[model samples]
Target chain A: MTRAFNFSAGPATLPESVLRQAQAEMLEWNGAGASIVEMSHRGPEFMAVAAQAEADLRTLMSIPDDYAVMFLAGGATTQQALLALNFAAPGQTCDYVVNGHWGKTAIKQVGHYVNPHVAASSEAGGFHDIPARSSWQLSPDAAFVHITANETIHGVEFRDTPDVGNVPLFADFSSSIASEPIDVSRYGLIYAGAQKNLGPVGVSVVIVRRDLLERAGQPRADIFNYRSHVARDSMLNTPPTWNWYLAGLMFQWMLAQGGVQEFARRNATKAALVYDAIDTSSGFYRNEVVPAVRSRMNIPFFLPDDTLTARFVSESKAAGLLALKGHKAVGGIRASLYNAMPVEGAQALVAFMRDFQQRNG
Target chain B: MTRAFNFSAGPATLPESVLRQAQAEMLEWNGAGASIVEMSHRGPEFMAVAAQAEADLRTLMSIPDDYAVMFLAGGATTQQALLALNFAAPGQTCDYVVNGHWGKTAIKQVGHYVNPHVAASSEAGGFHDIPARSSWQLSPDAAFVHITANETIHGVEFRDTPDVGNVPLFADFSSSIASEPIDVSRYGLIYAGAQKNLGPVGVSVVIVRRDLLERAGQPRADIFNYRSHVARDSMLNTPPTWNWYLAGLMFQWMLAQGGVQEFARRNATKAALVYDAIDTSSGFYRNEVVPAVRSRMNIPFFLPDDTLTARFVSESKAAGLLALKGHKAVGGIRASLYNAMPVEGAQALVAFMRDFQQRNG
Candidate 1:
């Protein structure tokens, strides 16, 4: 298979090794008589897969003993409202730090369930930078503080995990999970859609402090209630068994590649190469995200001549680097350097950009 | 590769053709140079897949133009609450015809959001029979009338779709969908998990009459509202892309195999073979479900000597037939003959049953 560098953000690229292994075992998993996609979730074949996946993920993240790890359906978008509906008491405020589109969306979802307090926002500057931690007007008794650790569209990331003081810090780690080692003990909850660094779409990994699970509202819809899922070990329903199995494969892949630290190093290198290309382009390319907080997962850059963006995307596709067109919300080009995109792919993109700039210039 | 006859209730068997096709395309789908699972849901490649899948499903079911078919995350379990929350007005009654476990669970979930009227129930008889339409105590002005067309665990099926008259009849077609030709226009809504006769788990297909979409509640958590999903073409969130793709394959497979009519015939033949084995066993093996409404998909039977169930399950596995153990809710053996399970598989099971009974009777 002549594979290209796939850069589309979440339902994003996965380890080629994982995909190869999935292909090899698609019809019969581990000498079992049925495919992973076709195995009963309750049976030993799949239950062991689900259990191993959860355990591997816990070890990769160094998840604390008090945390409950769940592989849930409904992506980060669902988790946004679930967090507010479950965490906030009646009339309590849900605090949000909105640096990008996903954060704004989370606030809107939360506002439907509870009044969301926008503690800090970078929307005024077209979300070109992550807001300073000191600029955050945090509520002293806020029910929980929410943040999108890596903004996919805006290409901004938290340089350091913020200190939310006493408020439970809940994070949408969708774009950056497993790209770095996170201090799981500090957050009340961390959810990441698997499509981005983990595996495929539809499955999300949620790590919630066990005690905080009690704070979730009782009257919420049964499936929406995390407690229902936690109670059943995330098999509250059939679950995306194939996705869960693929995730287990990905967890093993990460472990084989020397865990999260190695992934973090590779991710940093890929991000730097693409960023360097944009920086040395002599004003031809510009990425507005503050260099200090530039995202290592998604990097969005612009051509000085906006009309050149279309040609660049078309030409990039021809050159075998896929899905570089930026989101309409943040127009230009976005090269998402998730864990699966090697530094070599980034170097190829940089080479393409240099050639394109010279010819267009 | 030695494949087995898998009788798992769900996440069950799949066509070898589909599995082979999926394996071939796992690394690079349709020359796109990326796994279909890795493609962006919004991209042309994936969107084309989504559109084709919807079109194929619509054709297979003969779904009318007025219905909005959506691919949604969370399984049938989530649909339980979503049906009540999306269709019923606040404080209005919803009527349910409960024939088995899933139906009972739906009623319980609906009761949390709206008062559900138990219009009919066969639970009084241990769910061995479907409640008769004549004995139903349906509320006249119920927002909707709900039924489980086929109960997987109980192995009971509605011989024909009920005429609920003015009330919108919403059917959970989870186990029975695509098993036969049905009048899609007769029901207000039909939703099914893509596990049994469709595809793998994680995604469900909801076919709601377009007019009913407006009946959704005003203050719903955005993701919970059907309207939110309808507006976005079920891209309300990332959606279960892998499940959707697999369902597309299943839809194609169904279409190629002469669609629902052909499937129904094969299913009838398969169910008859298994039932014939039990019926001819002379008090050794028994099925409690009233034969008139016996399921074409799930066939639950009892052995006179209950202690032999484990031996039957184990010996069946050894003989290359798998997962014949019945649900814990009702103990014995259940052979789920979904569309993917060939008639030959059932014939093999029947032959095995005859041999086992002769040796041990």
Candidate 2:
């Protein structure tokens, strides 16, 4: 089994080059005489690696000086809980624009610490579309307006950033981050688990407005405080060094491939290829997401029945097109076209889809 | 340079065979068609990897069926915070037996959630000794008695588990876990960051008595709840898949090498070699730790002055001994003799020390 076009939707496909470099350095990184995994987070060897990663990320994302970046361990779900603990006062109103499964999850994580008001939701419509910006009923005293920029499970995305007046805007950009360019200064905070668009699992990247760190949101341990992590340069404790290092490799690869603008163009091309197949499949396939707001990163579509969906998954795996199974929350098929998915991989998937439709339709 | 003997603590050293296996499998793991890092945590391949790791660890440690094992992120400090949040009520008393820097750090993480009473501390003695068990002022109504089983920085270890009446005993075994055989049933909870003796940096092993999961500790998010993680088999969210996978390989390697009992004998030999060098140095070099409690894991020793110590570090690195620099918290030279550090590595280090002393003295 050679490397396949993996569309597993995070811990998804990584650039093969990144994997190769990591493999080459697995025994001893550079001249350090130890794998990056075995070195201290504070040691000079890893410190340089950590710094280069941060600098590269900042360059790749065009992150501003005022925003502090953190490479943390517990992924976005943990960050979801920490958002309320670090930025919101106890029981403070937090306006959550629930567009899909991840947005709902974001709200669930904060229920104990905040007054999470559902400003708008697409769940009433089975999470197939993003709620209109005009339909939201936000709290005036909300600590932050939270949104999932791209919902991996629902395959719904906010094509445009919604303006939320005075309150800071926060977003979970797990699936869509770095797939394209974004105005980083517009959001108070943006967090993403590295597995999807970035590099690997176990580490997450958190970008936050530095002034927000002064907020004494709630009583919490120092380990839970974002300020402490940022102050320590994300070496608050022994960081997930290997994960961070792998992610660094990813950042460098992304930068070498001409950064977010280049990825945006590639992602647009890839999304079009797959969506074209689904649209032209007529009765054989259907995607419920509105064309205007369908996620370029994750495209969830359904076949006629459960039997065909299972067949598509197994057949795709056999055909070297992998992880086309949709999230269990919405059973069908989901093809995630994250940053690393080459344009050729999308073309191959579309070809597979057409051949499958001809045989099964 | 080729791989050297890496000895800096936590994210310290790994078995060469484990590194070789990981290096071989980094591109694609076990015909899974993707790197383990690039697979979903809930996918069959990673789920099997995660399960086998847990089973192997249970076999290695002789953990009882009554105890639940969890592989988590955020390392030991986060576990330190979660320990208080999961086991003790808000403002409830928790006894902390502080022996070294890490013990003090454990107490620091829980101050917001618990009334942490320092029942005993060896800080006044420059953390050169573990506090006497008989001298500890045990709390009558404490939720749990906490201890650092081995202090990585101070080079002190609790050679015996203290008998705490009624209260559950919890230990941070971050540096010394799986280095020797132990009675898992005696401790209510034992946690270790995998960077040390286990395998990698991101994932942590948590062994907890099952009955403790029923305790309603405090108000916290679902992400912070251990019972939720236990229910999901540590898949409450996307775990660090690569880290978890690498750890599984380490468990297999450890088991094949005759488990903890074999490593215990190896660790004793390695610790003895270094300690003998420091002990016989005739005032030129010294280890201040009390002999009975001197950590067989990390041995921190000092030279007569700063210049010789600096020279030793640079010369050692050039001599193919890497990361010989001591922790910034306690300066001088420190050698960590983890389960993975072969007896030959220790022998080489002692040889270097003798050669350097002959020239420097």
Candidate 3:
């Protein structure tokens, strides 16, 4: 059966091949006499699964030897609070770069632990572009600088990692983690909630530098203490074993599909196809973001007539494009083209958009 | 194919029937083009799944209207800290009844948020018996009292819920939740990590009374806040969707098997077979826990001579019985007969034990 292309921002689409492989192994995992979900986390079978997952992810990201890969629970929202707990202690402050809805939400959530100083914000620009690095007013005494590398809602992204001087840099790459090649050494911490380009929901991947883990020496913090997780190898508690197993399968799939470099080319091609359709539509189908900061992962666009928005989503769904409805905060339509979304799906969406524009205009 | 009888503590054993059903619907669930794992959590399909799971659980436990059932991420270990964060605020004390390894671990983790007072403990008794209720030093002004209804490792269980007067009672029923009928009104909060009898390891079920949730009006408790989880219907964050779906299936299966009442009878029969073997072993096999407080879920026993322990586990494996090794902290054998373990499995274990005793003794 031909699978419909899913464009959900999260809890999003996964590779069909990966799903088939998981289905085949649902009952018996390689003659282990039990499914991976039924295996104990402390058992040797699951240990190998966990170890291989971390190793494959490390190799794919070209992660430095100094960085420790940790698989945790809770989504990116939990990480927003956890980052504050681990990096900024009570009375300490952190620099935050607000580019879009996700950045603003991060600031609001992290404000509970530390005073979040807005280093730079693009809210004045209607979240269409990132604030220039020179305009950022970074605090010298701040614990770290936080940024959302790609904003899923606004369809904006930072093309390069920002240098925060002596302060450690942390990025919530929830939407863009595996889409392109990245220099892992540039950031002290990188976290991605695994609903997007990774595997499934419920498991979060965190890459933390060793030195930054030392800051988690706070007396009272419980689950957010990075040191505790690092020491126990992310098994300080029973992890979301099924999600971790799925993630391992995803990593293996990514490797088989020519790794990150190949993924980067495909992502570029898919994004360009959709962007080209939007560009050719003139004022009919308009994408708000500036070309320089537009995301390759998520593309948000709108029709000239507000009434046409609902019609567009309904028609698109009928045409086998799902989850095309934009986030409520950003009205119109959003097409999230993650790693699992094939280029053919993007071409189909572009073709549909072109046909809709000709008829509506 | 005949499935092996698995007895690993958690992420342990699931009903083979559940696995078969899950395998059948792995790619397309009920003619829905998407797998349950692939569907959006906010979609109507998944909403039905999440709602049905909560409804089934409520029916199984006889939960009242005032109590909210939340399907949350993180295991029971996270709940230990979360319970302290929600109920036991700073400067307040929470009482902990330590019966075994899990109880002690909960106390140590809860120490991060509040002063955890060890109201009663069985560690002094080699963790083989539940502490007498009369010996407990109940604190009048305590925020809440915590207990492990069934200790998976030490094989000790509270045969009956303790009366904590007006202080709210919170029990971690990780290993015992679905094995028997539980009175929900007696406790203010009850949580179970889903690896045992529920489903998988990614999701934890939290049932909290409305008034107890009112106590969690703090500013920054994050995902651990029970009120926030209840307010959002466990969708405060993207929950462990697949795990929740799997848990719902297990709940349905339990219902088909005649709910917790029928489960209790089957559990009693299963526990009796192993315990009876130990009782009639005539100095060959011995169970150390006091009979009145012995667990009907986990049966931990020892050989008369310690030298045969390795042989016992190895021969059991050869006979198609797996994971009979005891927890590292408790150096003996433990048979965890959660709801998924049928009477036939328990009988097989008993038959294996009798044969081993006849040959080795």
Best by DockQ: 2
DockQ class, candidate 1: medium
lDDT of 1 by residue, B1-361 (tens): 7889899999889999999998999999999989999999999998999999999999999999999999999888888888877888776889999999999888767665788888989998999998888999989889999999999999999999898889999999999998999998999999999898896788899999999988855356788889889899999789898889989998999999999999999999999899999988997899998989999999999887677888898899999998899999999999999999998999899999999999888
In candidate 3, which residue ranges exceed 4 Å CA deviation? B216-219, B305-307
Interface RMSD of 2: 1.1
DockQ-based CAPRI category assigned to the predicted complex of candidate 2: high
Off by over 4 Å in 1: A216-218
State in Å the error of residue B14, model 1: 0.6
- In terms of DockQ, which candidate is stronger, 1 or 2? 2
Give fnat, all candidates: 0.75, 0.86, 0.53
DockQ of each: 0.78, 0.84, 0.62
Overall local distance difference test of candidate 3:
0.87
User: Ten consecutive residues with minimal summed lDDT in candidate 2 chain B?
Assistant: B1-10
The CA lDDT of each predicted structure is 0.89, 0.93, 0.87
Q: What are the per-residue Cα lDDT tens digits for candidate 2 across B178-281? A: 99999999999999998999978899989999999999999999999999999999999999888888889999999999999999999999999999999998
Q: How well is candidate 1 docked (DockQ)?
A: 0.78
